[model samples]
Target: MTTAKDLLIIAIEVDPSGPVGQGDLSLALAGAELIDLLGTRAVTLTGDRVLPAGDAVPEDRLLAEAVASLDREAPYETVDDWLWRRGRDLFAAYTAVLEEDGQLTRERRRRMSFAAPRTTVAESAARRRALHRWAADEPVILALAAAVGIESEQTEEEAVVTNDAVTTVLAAVHDAVMELEAVRRRRSFENAAFANVWRGA
Candidate 1:
């Protein structure tokens, strides 16, 4: 079963322009893993929010710890809230695993005196093939695409869409775009719902 961490790594490698900073990349990766685990029934999601399922944690150390955290929550957390804050640890942990697996190598670079680790893809063809297959099969893209498209059509088909209704549409479109971007930074990640706003290519 592919975790979000794996998908993030693959996305980074596949994108020609790599991540700009470690912080953004790590959190984004963590969010991806959270979503993946949820879809696998390892956790639960209600709308965009995530709640831990009362089930045994998986054997995968990374996912197990994440699930445990969610399950142990006082009053469960939204997946974005949890991952955006704590994903750095998960990203670091998974990169070490990839380094050991010989698919990537890490090198440290100093950016304004702070050390930033750079990841180089070592096994390109194999990894790309795997990512491609995952992209084709993953449900996230479809969900996001539909959401963005529907929201845009609604807004455009009616010139006088209510302020409250427009706000709701924007929120849904933003959530979908954010998740889709985290998964695959490809051209297809865009939809007309965000035409007025800038979405990084």
Candidate 2:
């Protein structure tokens, strides 16, 4: 299973309503895709920039699309740029693909007629593989998960990923998530201030 798929499955199975909101999770998933591409040598990291290292397309549709979207020119794309550009609504994209592949199922909302149906990870070999990898505390996956605020039993120091490229991508993901959170907080405060002004408080 691809690391992106495994990471998505683990996220859904663990706690869909937890600290890792869609935005944070999406950024991490984008990082996960890059990590997988690095694994296949489809791309490489030159410092913090992503350099396309191969012309072969990945077998996975999303991954192939990712490879196709690379900036092939000089200076290439920075990992930070790729994360934001590629990660826009990426969680929805991955969920739709998983549902199409029968790795995820959407449960009908019985009472809340206006609410979106709840999606759950289906019982499949894919899920089993993800769980196994999570159980083993694989450094890359663990680090990706931690980026989204999903804490594993493994401590921070113990979850060190050896590959420098992977480590760079993971750090980028964490920074992106933190930046997104900061944006969220700033907007929230602004909205609250606006509401208070309107209320003459």
Tell me each candidate's TM-score. 0.55, 0.96
lDDT of 1 by residue, 14-124 (tens): 552543344444554565566556556766666555666658767766777776767455466655576555565655677777777676776678667575676776766
Which pairs in model 1 have colliding backbones? Answer: 4-33
lDDT string for model 2 (1-201, tens) is 689899999988986768778999889989999999999999999999999999898899999999999999988999999999999999999988999999999889878599888888999999999999999989888988988988889998998788899889999999999999999999999999999999995
Question: How much lDDT does each candidate structure score?
Answer: 0.53, 0.92
State the lDDT at 84 in candidate 1. 56
| Predicted structure 2: lDDT | 0.92
Which candidate number has the best lDDT? 2
Candidate 2, superposed: residue stretches over 4 Å from native: 112-115
Model 1 misplaced stretches (Cα beyond 4 Å): 16-19, 47-49, 71-74, 106-118, 124-129, 134-201
Report the CA-based lDDT of candidate 1 relative to the real structure: 0.53
Error of 1 at 154 (Å): 22
Lowest lDDT block of 10, candidate 1: 144-153
